[model samples]
Target: MKRSKTSKSWMNEHVSDIFVRQAQSDGYRSRAAYKLIEANEKFKLLEKGMVVVDLGAAPGSWCQVINNAIGSQGKIFALDLLEMHPIKNVDFIQGDFRDELVLHELENKLNDLKVDLVISDMAPNISGIKTKDQAGIIHLNELALDFAINWMKPNGNFLVKSFIGEQYESFIEAARVVFTRVTTFKPKSSRDRSAEIFIVGQKIKNIEQLNDFGLE
Candidate 1:
C-alpha cells in the first residue's frame, strides 16, 4: 500500500522525535510512559501496595510504568480494546472497557477490591473533524471519570489525559465536584503542538459535597 504524504511526513517526524528515541533506549513500549512517570513524581499518585486500574493500556507502556513503580506489592489491571503483551505481575483485559460485559468482567477480576488509582490515557479514534473529534475525546474522559467515581477508594486519585476543547472546563468542574482537589498539567515530554493535558483529581469528596455541588 502506498502511504500518503501526510502519513509519511508524520512517520519521519515520529522516528526523529526525542521521546521516541528515549523510549527505544529505555525499553519502554511507547513515549507515553514518560508522561505517567512525570505525573507520579509531581503528584505522588502511585504507592507501594496500591491497586490501580489503567485504561487504554496497550501497547502497555503505562502498565510498564505502573509495574516498575509499584513493585511486587502493588496490583495493576490494564484494560484496552486491543490485546496487549503480558507484563510481569500485571493483569491484562482485552475489550471495550465501557461495555457492561467488560465492566462486569473487570469488576470480577478485582473481586470487590477498591481501586487506589484510576489512570486513563484513553482517546477515541480521530476522524479529522474538530467538533466530532472533541466530542469523542470528551466522551472517553467522561466514561473514565464515571468509573473513578464508582470504584475509587477515598483519597484515591484519578489521572486522565484530556485536551483543551469544548468540554474541557465542564469536565474539570465535574471532577472538582467529586474530588477534593483537581488540577490540569502538561508534561514537558508531550509535544509542544499537542493540546493534551493531564487532569489530576485527588481525594474523592464525600457524597454530601457531591450533592451540594450538584454532581450527585
Candidate 2:
C-alpha cells in the first residue's frame, strides 16, 4: 500500500533530524536521548551514585543516557509496556507501568533505597485526536508524579514529558506543592512545532505533603 502524504513527510523529517543523525554517530539508540541529556544539562538532575527510574522507557534511549550520565556507580530501573533492547547497567522491566504487579516489581528493585531521580518520556500512541492525546500526556504525567512522591528521596528530582495544553498550567501549579522548584523545559532537540515540554520538579520534601497538593 502507498503511504499517505503526511506519513511520508513525517518519515522524511524523522530521517533528516539532526539529533537522529547525531544519535547514529554517537552510538545512542534513538534521538530521544538528546532530550534527556539536554534537560539534565539545564536542571543538573543526573549524578554519580544516584538511584534513578526511567518510566515508559522504550528503545532504551533514555536508559542509555541515564546510564552514561550516572556512570557505573549509579543504578537505573527502567519500565515500559513495549519491549526494549537491553542496555548495560540498566534493569529493564517490560510491563505496563500502570499495572500493580509492575509497580511492585519497581518497588522491589528499590529495596529500601529512595530514588534520586525519576524521568518519564511516556507518550500515548498518537491517534490524530489532539484532545485525547493531550489527556493521555496529562495522565502519564500524573502517574509519573505519583511514582516520584512514593519512591523518591526528600530532595529527589522528576523530569516528565507533558503536552502544553489543557492541564498544563494546573499540573505545574500542583507540582509546586510537592517540589520546592518546578519549571518547564523545551530542549533544542525537541521539535519547534511539537507541543511536548519537559516538566522538572525538584526537592520533593515529603510524600504526605503531596496529598495536600492534590496530585495524590
Candidate 3:
C-alpha cells in the first residue's frame, strides 16, 4: 500500500527528530520519554517509593521514565486501549480507561493505595474535524482530571496531555478549582507545530474547596 504524502512527511520528520534518535540511543521506548523527563526535572514530580499511574500508557515510554525515576520500592500501574509489551516493575492493564469497568480494574490493581502521581499522555483518535477533535481532547483531559481528583493522595500531582483550542482556558481554570497550584508547559521535545500542551496540577485541594472541576 502507498503511503499518503502527509504520512510520508511525518515519517521523514519523525525519523529526523533529534529526540527520536536520542531515545534510540538511550534505550527508551519512544521520544515521548523526554517530555516526561523534562517535566519531572522542572516540577520535581517523581520520587522514590511513589505510587504512580500512567494513562494511555502504551508503547511504554512514559512508563519507562516512571520505572527509572521511582525505583524499586515505587509502584507503577499503567493502562491503555492498546497492548503494551511488559516493562519491569510495571503492571499494565489493557483497556479503554474511560470505561467504568476498566477503571475498576485499575482500582483493584492499586489495592486502595492513593496514587502519589497521575500522568496521562492520552489523546483521542483524530476525526480531522477541528471542533470534534478539540472536544474529544478536552473530554479526555476532563476525565483524566476527574480520575486524579478521585484517586490521588492529598498533595498528589496530576500531569496530563491537553490541546489548545476552544474551552482551553476554562479547562485550565477548572483545574485551578480542584488543585492548589496549576500550571501549563510545552516540553522542549513537543513539536513546535503541535497545539498540544501539558497541564500540571499539584496537590489536590482539601475536600471542602473542590467544587465542579469538570468544566461546569
Candidate 4:
C-alpha cells in the first residue's frame, strides 16, 4: 500500500526521534511514556496505594509508567476507544470513554474507590484543519476535566494533554476553577514544533464550589 506524503514524513520522523529510540531501548510501549514520567517527576503526583484513572490509554504507554510508579500498592484503571493488551496491576477497559456503557463499566470497576489522580492523553484524529483539531482537543480536555472533578478525591490531581491555541485560555480558566492551582507544562519529550502541551491541575477542590468558581 502506498502511504501519503504526510504519513511517510511522520513515519520517518518517528523513526528518527531520539525519544522513540530511547523508549525502545527502555522497553516502554511508546515514546509518550516519557512525557508522563517527566510530568510526574515535576509534580510528584503518584503515591503508594493511590487509585488512578487513565483516559484514552490505548497502546498502554502511560499506564505502563503509572504501573511502575505505583507498583503493587496502587491501582490503575484505564479506558480507551481502542483495545489494549493487559498490563499487570492495570485494569484495562477497551471502549469509548464518552459512551454511557463504558462509563458505567468503569464506575462499576471503581466500586466506591476514590481516584487520587486522573491522567488523560487523549488526542483527536487530525484532519489537517488546525481549528477543527484544536476544538476537538479542547473538548476532550474538558471531558477529562469533568471526570477528574466528579471522580477524584479532594486534593487529588489531574494531568491532561491540551493544544496551545486561541481556545487555550478558556480551558485553563475552567481548570483553575476546579483546582487550587493549575499549570501548563510542555515536557521535553514533546515535540517542539507541536503545539501540544500538558495541563496539570493539582489539589482538586470541592466540586460543589466549582460552579461558583466558573467551572461547569
Number of backbone collisions per candidate: 0, 0, 0, 0
Clash count, predicted structure 4: 0
Provide the overall lDDT of each model, using Cα atoms, as 2-decimal numbers. 0.90, 0.88, 0.91, 0.90
Report the C-alpha lDDT of model 4 over 1-216, residue by residue, as the tens digit: 899999999999999999999999999999999999999999998887889999999899998888888889999999999889899988889887767798889999999999999999999888989999999899889888887877889899999999988688999988888889999999999998988899999999886787676554
For 1-216, candidate 1 gives per-residue lDDT tens digits of: 999999999999999999999999999999999999999999999888889999999999998888888889999988999989999988989999768899888889998899999999988777878788888878889988888888878788999998888988999988888888998999989999887899999999876776686655
Show pairs that collide, candidate 4.
none
lDDT (C-alpha) at residue 6 in model 2: 100
- Candidate 1's C-alpha runs over 4 A off are 1-4, 211-216
- Higher-lDDT candidate among 2 and 4? 4
**What is the C-alpha lDDT profile of model 3 across 58-153, one tens digit per residue?**
999999999888899999999999999999999999999779999899988888899999999999888889899899888888888888878888
Q: Please report, as a residue range, the 10-residue window in candidate 3 with the lowest summed lDDT.
A: 207-216
Residues forming the 10-long window of minimal summed lDDT in candidate 1: 207-216
Candidate order by TM-score, decreasing, is 3, 1, 2, 4
Per-residue C-alpha lDDT of model 2 across residues 1-216, encoded as one tens digit per residue: 999999999999988999999999999888999999898888999898889999989998888888887899999999999998888888989998878898899889888988999989999988989899988889889888888888888799999999988988888987888899999889999999988898999899675676665555
Total clashes, candidate 2? 0
